[model samples]
Target: MESGKLLKAIIESAIDGIITIDNRGRVESLNPAALKLFGYKLEEVIGRNISVLMPEPDKSSHDGYLHRYQSTGEKRIIGKGREVRGLRKDGSTFPFRLAVSEVQYDDRVIYTGFIHDLSKEKEAEQRLKEYAAELEELVNERTKSLKKMLHALSEAKEEVSLSLLKEKELNQMKSRFVSMASHEFRTPLSSIQLSSVLIEKYAEPFDNPHIKKHVSKIKNAVGNLTTILNDFLSLERLEAGKVEPAFTPFDIVKLSEEVTEEMQMIAKEDQNIIYQHTGIESMVNLDQNLLRNCMINLISNATKYSGEHTFIEFNTEVTDTQCIVTIRDNGIGIPESDQKNLFQAFFRAHNTGNIPGTGLGLNIVQRYAGLMGGELHFESKINEGAIFTLSFKR
Candidate 1:
């Protein structure tokens, strides 16, 4: 009697839900845990078919399974754990793990089932599946955005390449036009100059001021046009990389004197260009043609900008280490702001007013100096004077 009470106490105190059924599958007893798990009282479930606590197909098949097992002694759900659903008192269902074991009593048989709830684990698994689907969708959206950006960059690169090709063709055509026009205009310009000189010579005997003035104007206009054509031709050749200096042994003193004499005829009224050689050595190896052109350009600038009776200083020096030439003039000096761009092609100083110039002389002179491996630098002050120095290493 004591042993029977102890066994009952142990079963009632168990944490897991426990239930016992007769060989015929009728619920005979249940622990307190089993009663609370199904939301039923012991009196309500006692003597009822065990299928009352089962759900769906299991509820309907329990009786046949029990009969088959009793007759054939086949163990299908016996001595093993099965995941199954239990029907609650409110007609709702929940998942649980059920373990059944057949117990042999004195003359009859009974099945005891232990039940562990699994509702929480199943809910957590469903949540994980939903999270994985959301992450995949985000990855797909980012990939699509990246592909669109790459496509736009490719299109932009192609457009830039096309623009560069068109610009190259345009530059080549412009160079060709300049070369042809300069050569074509030269013949007419020479004829105009010659005719003006002849007109001046013939009209001097008549002493007509109008005839002399008009001839002078014609000569000046023709000279200006010739300068423009020459500037354009020089720039075209430089851009095509065709201008190279030819070095030779020449008398510096002779070249300086010759350049001054040639340029003196074109100077502004009464403007004097003084030529001097300060160096002892008279002969030096250099590009004679290029040097003559540079000296002529500088003197012309000085003569053009200076007022009547102003003096332009031209000096040359040849030392053991270097050869130097300097030209200084009192003229409408370049502004401090304009000095920086003095050697840029087609860029005239802002201070120049109504002056006949192509603004390409200094640029060409600088380039010519560079081809001879020389340096050109200058100094100027507004309304005062300007000085340019050209030097070559020995």
Candidate 2:
């Protein structure tokens, strides 16, 4: 009696739902917690089967499970917690975590169950899951926006780089054009002035031959000026995309002769231009006007900077598909420090100090060479000489 009373007190005081069943699986006891967990009272469930608290199929087949356990001694729900449904007094059902334990007392077998309510825990777990989903969504959104911003930044940088490159190219072209125009214009202006002065001073006092010579000089100077202006206009046309290369068969030797003859008087007293043609005398397709200007610029430069009696050598060699021309001069050669800026506009060599020049000769020569599908190459040694080579494809 004392032991039964002690067990009753322990069952009623349990924090978890406590229930006990007899050896025949009948409900023997029900605790206060069990009453609250299942919405049943001791008077209602104590004499009924333990399956009264279960719903549906379990309520019908639980006796068989107990019979099998007794026969084989297998334990399924005993000493383990599992999720199951329970019945309430109102005929409604609620989910729970159920644990059952078996105890033996005085040849009687008893089962005790502890039940835990799951609604509150399930609600808490669902809330945590919802928070996690929201966090993942926020991270994906931020990542997408950051990636878009990075791509835009990359495109902006590329545009800035391209713009800067174009600006640099324009500046270089402007410098070259300005230098060539100044030099080319100055040459003709000087020639025209000198010729006019000679004609004015000597035409009345000198013989007919002298007057004729003066007039010829003025005409030649005017013609040269016209050529220079035409070359400048051609450059403008090329830059404006209006001029295309005219390829036609022509003799490079003939072009060299004409240029040297035109510049003969300008050559120093000690310097004379010599043209040597080597290899086959075959005609190559090229821009005649552009090639002529390139040769003229090179030859004129040689004449301008060379000593009084130095030899200005013009040599040409033709291969199967190309023609190479080299103009060499033994004069005050360019300094090493100024070699890099040779093709820059208005950048005259230090050696040409006080020399009458506009400093666009090399720049124009380089541009003309490029226009003719050729390249201009040079070599210079201070006080030794300079060699300029123009190579064109056949």
Candidate 3:
């Protein structure tokens, strides 16, 4: 009796509710904690159905749930703790966590349910989940903004690098132009001054041949000066965006013939300048002076680099929408590595190291070609010489 009293004391003192149910779903025993937790006394609930302690919807469904489990030999919440609702003696429903255990005692089946108040824990868990979700969204937004800022910073760096490169290129071009003008112009000017002084001092004593030769030399010097000045002026105009090209229709065959004839005097005595027109002639709109300059530069390059006795050929071909003028030279060809920088200003090929040039010739040609809506292209093999093609859009 003393042991029984002590056992009862232990059951009543337990923090968790202790309840035992029989096979018929009727409560067999209810401890003090269970009675107090459900707002019931042992005398009132001991013989009552366990469904009476459950909330309304659960009260109606508990029998079916137990019958299904018994028929199927399946356990639903037998060993699991899940959120549920409990009914107090006052008819108020409160949230709880429930766990059940099944036992066999002397040929009788019994179920013990352990109930825990779940309101505070559930509310805390819900708040934690909400906080985590909000934190994830904030982190994602910050990452997106960081990516955009990085992209913008990358673009700004690229723009700054490009601007610096352009400035460096412009400064280099100015320096080259200044050096070229000083040397090329001063030589010719000095010659003209000396020649004029000699002619004026010995005007009466000089014979016809001597007089004519001096006069011719002066004229040639002046002509060279004028050509240099024109090239420089054209470059300035192009740089200033002041060239309003007057495009007029012109015959391709006629233009080639005239360019070839003009270049005859400059070609080596043993070299031949051939102009071959492939098929019918075509007419295209372009600036005549700009096209002429382009042609002159190409011809001059051919004359300057070709073998003394080799033939330099000029050939033209017309397509549906484009015309190609090809100038072939048999000379020392450009190295493959140097071809990439061929069109750059002041860039000369390794093979033309000994060739005399202002280096502005091809630069002018390329500029004029761009102005006329055309392109200057070339192909070459070492020792086999080169073929420069001017492609003009119709």
Candidate 4:
């Protein structure tokens, strides 16, 4: 009797709802928890069909299922836990987990079912899903904001780079202008001053030869000043897009001879300007003024850089499609490091120390060559010699 009471106490005190049904499917007994879960009184539920506690198809088919199980001993919902819908006394339905077990006492069979309501678990699961979705949306929004910031930073960086490049170009132009003015103006001014002093000294007695020499020096200094002014003016015109090539057919050999003769008068003592023509054609269509300027720049550079008595070779090779002029001199050539910037405005080779120049000559010549659709190239080694070749296509 004591053991039977203990078992009854355990079933009645369980947290989960508990119920037992007889072989006829009538509710034989139920716990207080079961009564509270189903909203039923013990007297009103006892001896009633157990299907009254189930909803829908399970409520209507419970009798047939029990009859089949009793006749065949088949095990469907017996001895297993599964989710099922339960009916309340108020005709409402709710989800629950159920585990059913069968017990045989002598020739009678009984079934016991344990039930647990699942409402809280399902609600908690739905809340977790909502939180995850909100987190994903927040992450996506932050990522888009970050990408926009990066794009803005990239644009800012590009603007800064362009500003820096323009500033550097301006600085270079300013430096070149100052260097060119100081070097070019000083040379002619010095020559004029010395010649004036010499002419004053030779005026009293009037030595004709010495006076003529000083006068010639003064004339040459004036010419140097004129040439410097012309170069600067030409550069300004080229920059302003005002200069245009005037192409005309002219005698290249006669032009070359005349230029060489003029350069020889200013050449160093015992120095010679050698001129040679290899091609048959003497007359060619080209910009005579620009061609003469280029040749003068090259030949003058050679003579200025070389020592006294050095021979300067000027050779012209003519073809059906083009004319090539080569001016070679045995002189102090360009250094390896300075060769690349040879045609930049006011850029002089480091090896040209003590040589008087404005450093704008090669730059002007290069621009003139480009205007005529020609190219200038050179080969040189330090202290050995330099060869400058100018090619003009007809």
Model 4, 243-267: lDDT tens digits are: 7999999999999999999999889
Off by over 4 Å in 2: 1-238
Could you tell which candidate, 3 or 4, scores higher by lDDT?
4
Clash-forming residue pairs, model 3: none
lDDT of 2: 0.71
What global local distance difference test value does model 1 have?
A: 0.81
Residues 302-389, model 2: lDDT tens digits: 8777878678998888899779989999878999999999987446888787665545667777877787789989999998889999
Worst 10 residues of 3 by lDDT: 131-140
Candidate-wise lDDT, in order: 0.81, 0.71, 0.73, 0.78
TM-score for each of the candidates: 0.57, 0.46, 0.47, 0.49
Over 4 Å off, model 1: 1-170
Candidate 3 local lDDT, residue 247: 97
Model 3 lDDT, residue 67, Cα: 80
Give the number of colliding residue pairs in candidate 2: 4
Query: Candidate 1 or 2, higher TM-score?
Result: 1
Give lDDT for model 3. 0.73
Q: Clashes in model 4: which pairs?
A: none
Q: Write the per-residue lDDT of candidate 1 for residues 1-394, one digit (tens) a residue.
A: 9999999999999877899999888898999988988999999999999999998899999999888878897764643478889999999999988888788987889988888887876775454334334333433443344335434433544455478885566456547656655665577668667766765675555466766666666666667767766777787788889998889999988999999999998897888899888868878789998999899999999888889999999999989988899999999999999988899876799978888786889999999999999999999999898999999998
Q: Of the candidates numbered 1 and 4, which has the greater TM-score value?
A: 1
Q: Judge candidate 4 at residue 180 and give its lDDT.
A: 59
